[model samples]
Target: MTTAVISDSSSLIMVGKLKRLDLLANLFQQIVIPHRVATEIQAKEDGVASLILAHPLVSIAATTRHELLALLDGTLGHGEAEAIALADEHQMILLVDEKKARKAAKNMGLKIIGLLGVLLLNHRRTHITGQDAILMLEQVKAMGFRVSARLESDFMTRLHNPITHWHSPNTLK
Candidate 1:
């Protein structure tokens, strides 16, 4: 089973874009977020927060001060660092949307994935079509999440010419 531990930013990104969460839940065997991440989402009072709180597959894990301290020296932000630490300590994949957090996780030899990566995985798994993934990306954009031009171009290309094989590096890129 694939286990993922996500930071607050990624959690908010998923919650803010509700459709993506369904796709992620379908793709991963287990989804976990730090308790702080959950609390932040709840404070936002968005539909994404309520949906995650009610989801059967999502789990909320608490953070330890020790783990947080370990990540303090990394390039990740407070929430993201804590999330990466938890994932690394527990031997789970870290789902982070922040570029610095992703890089920090990579430098630390921790597995990572992002919101866009999860959507691509859903498309590759046939859980959602390429067109559907594009539509969801639009939804995420509408929710005010930042997306890069390169990602937009790549997503359009994928939508236009859907890949036949479901390779990890390709789907997650």
Candidate 2:
């Protein structure tokens, strides 16, 4: 659990909705969401019943790159822009799901992973069972996290064959 990554609001909201925020806690040493991500989640209906910030592992981080954020905000949403800036400034892996945001981060040479990637990480780490991974992936797709048909097929194939899904034992270290 030593890996710490910056997250956009979408993954937080998706995991919260799936009631699997514990996977985040179990996977990362620290789960850092940009301050803008927090605000974005709070703007949703009736204001953040999820309370992901209340968790011991989750922390709100702010980015100082105002100019970068503004530039990113031109093409991305405020939360996504701020999240990208934070991940870039800190040089941490970004947990983002949007296609455009992912593209932006990759263009900037920043590491990016989706919520489904988190699921794969968890499965690889044995934080989640293979059956649970399949179920969760379907649930995430149903929740509308932009799972392409090919990606979904790939995930299912991997989930069904756990023997090949294991990372090196040191993956957690």
Where is model 1 more than 4 Å wrong at Cα? 4-7, 11-16, 64-70, 73-75, 158-173
For model 2, the stretches where C-alpha displacement exceeds 4 angstroms are 46-50, 161-173
Q: How many residue pairs clash in each candidate?
A: 0, 0
Task: Give residue 57's lDDT in candidate 1 (0 to 100).
Answer: 77
Residue 14 displacement in candidate 1 (angstroms): 3.2
Candidate 1 lDDT over residue span 45-123, tens digit each: 5567877767777788865657454645455566676677777678677777777777767777777777776777777
Please estimate how well model 2 matches the true structure, expressed as its whole-model Cα lDDT.
0.79
lDDT of each: 0.66, 0.79
- The digit string of per-residue lDDT tens for model 2 on 59-146 reads 8889999999989989999999999999889988888888899888878888777777688778888899878888887787787767
**TM-score of each candidate structure, all chains considered together:** 0.80, 0.87
The C-alpha RMSD of each candidate to the native structure, in angstroms, is 3.2, 3.5
